[model samples]
Target: MKLLNDDLRNQLKEVFQDMKDDVTIAVFTKSGTCNTCTETISFMEEIETLSDKIHLKKLDIENDAELAKAYDVQMVPSIVLLNKDEAYVGIKFNGIPAGHEINSFIPGILEVSGSGEQLPEGFLKQLETVKKPVNIKVFVTLSCPHCPGAVQKAHKLALENEFINAEMIEAQTFDEISNKFNVSSVPKIVINDQYEFVGNQPLEVFVEEIQKTQA
Candidate 1:
């Protein structure tokens, strides 16, 4: 049972061709308790086969507790992307990046591989003002067409600022956490677990919400 079909594989190969540097996909999973853990690893295996520059590291949340703690992984079936230097740059996916999330996942790889587009000078300057630690949780449903855009925007902000970290959480898979946050809508962006907005908003909206944390 292959997760990625031939058509998707071919497309990913073409997309991965633009990778300028190596990127490691470190996936954390637990054995029996986690439902999507196995499926997520299988999906990642397919992704690794597409590009020589993309490396995969499979780990268990329990057995690799120390490393998982270092990366601040709090859940199973989580993914952390590392740069060519294997440094954790605060990009993460807490569930399988299937469906529309493939949009965010591929771009995340490219960003870590040093092939991402640069943010505008104005945006860069705005990002520089973020001095406080910020955690961005983007709650998404796989079927939502607009969810990936919000996830990508959150990830792009994380990549530009070391003080910020972002994770895309599949709302259905993490329903309990979603319930805690009262996520009744798709593409719900929660910043620092305090402020929240719903939509595929512009980067300016994201920055404004993040800046609110510094206040």
Candidate 2:
């Protein structure tokens, strides 16, 4: 059987072909036994095979410390997609941007790179003013029932909207983060390392706070 199905590869090709401007896929990876290092690199390389329009660049994190830092790559094997001179569109997939998700991933990249319809209302301004990164630390245990929706919203914002450093830290295991942030309550969202909001709020509220946090 094929590694990636034909449908996905076709969709990927179509999206890149539709882009009216240049697109760069910058990937940073370091050689080692680091978690998901090899798999991430391989997946990225496979991604390149699907598109000529995507200018793929790879750098070793440890060796290219300054470049990695410039891209805000705290973790290994992060992919940032760029369109011409616009600011970077960051991607942090837990495993791979493959399978069913790739169906949406390709178009999302193209749309973000400015090949689609009008900017959704506040999107352009949000893109311009968000110079500083918004750090969103979501604290939740693995088994928390209500946590996934909050986490999904945050992750969706990170993927579709290029404005925040959204991370879902496992509250049960990471005793240090839990204690430091005083996550006495589950689903606590810490924005910009300063503002801590408890429980799940509406998406609009999360978006508003993330915009403020970015500014």
**3-51 per-residue lDDT for model 1 (tens digits):** 8878988998999999999999999999888998888999999899999
Worst 10 residues of 1 by lDDT: 1-10
User: Which lDDT tens digits does candidate 2 get at residues 1-215?
Assistant: 24566886786677678777666766667677556557666777767787666666777878888877766666555555666774565533322344343433455456545675654567545545666776676677645666655655565566555556565555644557579999888778888888778877777667677767654
TM-score computed on alpha carbons, candidate 1: 0.98
lDDT of 2 at 71: 64
Residue 7's lDDT in candidate 1: 91
Best by lDDT: 1
The lDDT values for all models are 0.94, 0.63
Clashing pairs in 2: none
| lDDT of model number 1 | 0.94
Candidate 2: what lDDT?
0.63
